[model samples]
Target: MKTLLFCMLGLGLTACGSSPKNAHSNQDELAMLVGTYTNGSSKGIYTFRFNQETGTAVPLSSAALPNPSYLVPSENGKFVYAVSEMNNSTAALSSFSFDKETGELRLLNTVPTLGADPCYVATNGREVLTANYSGGTMSVFPLQKDGTLAPADTLFQGEATGPDTIRQATPHIHCTVFSPDRKYIFATDFSADRILRFVVHPNNPIPQTSPEAVDIEADSGPRHLTFSPDGKFAYLITELSGKVIAFSYNDGRLKQIQTITADTVAARGSADIHLSPDGKYLYASNRLKEDGIAIFAVNPENGTLAKVGYQPTGIHPRNFNITPNGKYLLAACRDSNVIQVYKRNEVTGLLEDTHQDIVVDMPVCIQFGNYSARTKDTKN
Candidate 1:
């Protein structure tokens, strides 16, 4: 019954040596690391050398693993972490030592998530968290001094249900992430249609704050969330409703302020959501009935979203990313086995296909490593 939710749910950086001098720079070279589902031809995690200068993505290397469906690099670019989306008791989370220069991943350590079918992993260089879809729990692990993971500190479970009997019968924790300030952890419960909030410290595991979590529209199936650049607002994408809801943020409490539809064809299968680096636009990808990316112009004043347009994507765009420079958009189409590249219109917030795609097997997550070869003086 839980394995079916994966198919039914529709979907869904850096180095210690040198810090990202600035968010955007004149250098246009970037390293794109991709995580994939290994049931297909994908071996594990793969890499591509992207040249935003020429709009091309060239295959680099890949590491073998069971099913590294999601990947997150450490803040200093020293290590990378991935969730093995497995259903058996062997389900676990793996850590890898990253070589920024070579764009390679070396398996560091693997630890049990203490839950089944772990689908999401998040880290802030201090603690690592995984949200297990089937087990309905969020597993917490301490980040070792050497980048390895400690034994599970806790397996927090949710017991809330929404109005829908079938999809919201039990807790389905989809995504867990730390807020920008690193003071709070937000975990989304899909079946509960709620976003769980917790207070966390550098040396302490997250403690559920008062009021526990925030309830979105019943049966909305909240999947993922991202905070505004200013940390004054939060945007949540509902997988079941295919809508993006905006909320004002104050001292860890999120107040719902606005909601906008993310798909015109259907109200389901909304996969991933992200904001542009410039914080001027919001984008969410939808699978199933509408395999496209929803574009929204962000109201800088009130943090509201106005649908601008929709760009058709490859089949099942489970995840995508914007280049660090905020000039290109990469859509990882899971079923199509290709990552489509597009030239982003900064002014209009629209994406135009660049026709330079990276072919891979079941590319579900796309992340850009902070490694760049070009110097600051390099020409774009």
Candidate 2:
């Protein structure tokens, strides 16, 4: 079934280190690494090499796997963890060894998630955390010496309570991420519409479990979160309301400070959210109502967002990613089957289309890998 899907998606399994001349200039830096799932019956991972200089991306490698949806590159850039979004009732985390020089992924090992349909994943040091949306829980697993995941050591169940009974009757964990300081784990539940916080302890019996933490408003449908570079504030994207909420962070406690709609009164639909590396700009994408990207200027002192403007992207932009250099933003238009590139105007906090689009099937997530000076030396 998966092989048939890959064929339908037109994703060819190719070798790496053969990027085009314009796509492989020694002076051009590695800007982004986008991941897309195979369409139809396809099941595997496909990675693209993005050149920051020309705003062009070349296909690097395609590896067959099982429904790779969400990807999390390790902080050190040595490993990438991807979730196999399946309902096997025993979903697993698949590990890959990444080649910085060639942008190739070597499958390492896999460990059961102990839950179903694990969609989002995050890692800190030796531990990997995943949010099981269909299972209504979050699970924590340890990374082995060889990069495979260990059996889940902790599971945090979601609580059900909200006005929207249809979608809120059952627990649905959307995303799990760590605080900038790595002291707390924040898991957003779409059904409950609350962000659940957990304290971390490396030596605890279950390092990912914490019962004493605050819960935010119900029915807000918190999806993703980003912390200020200074670690003084945290911003959350609420899917239900199509708004961004800002909160003050003091010693791991997040206090709601403000909320602003990501779209104008004339716009609708929800998408992913991200903050600039300089902490001066916030970018949010919309999936419906004339799909586009929303830009905002961040007030450093109060942590508030001021609307800048919106830029049209392709259809159904499910996720987008910013390069490590902070010069470009890439949108993954799932419905359009193309990844659109945009240049970020640092001064004005706006995005201008780069006129470069990479074709793929159901491209859902975009993630960047750090470029290494060592890799360049070895290549030369």
Provide the lowest-lDDT 10-residue window in model 2.
1-10
lDDT by residue (tens digit), candidate 1, 43-62 = 78986666665566555567
Tens-place lDDT digits, model 2, residues 1-380: 01111123344554333454444564455624455565553346666566666666656666676767788877667788888877876477888887755677888888878778888889885788899888888988877766677888878998778666766788878888888887788888777777888888757525545554456666667778888889998988876677888999987788988888885543436768888889999988877677888888999999988888898889988899887667888898988877778899889979988776666677888887666442432110
Best by lDDT: 1
- The lDDT of each candidate is 0.81, 0.75
> Which 10 successive residues of model 1 have the least lDDT summed?
1-10
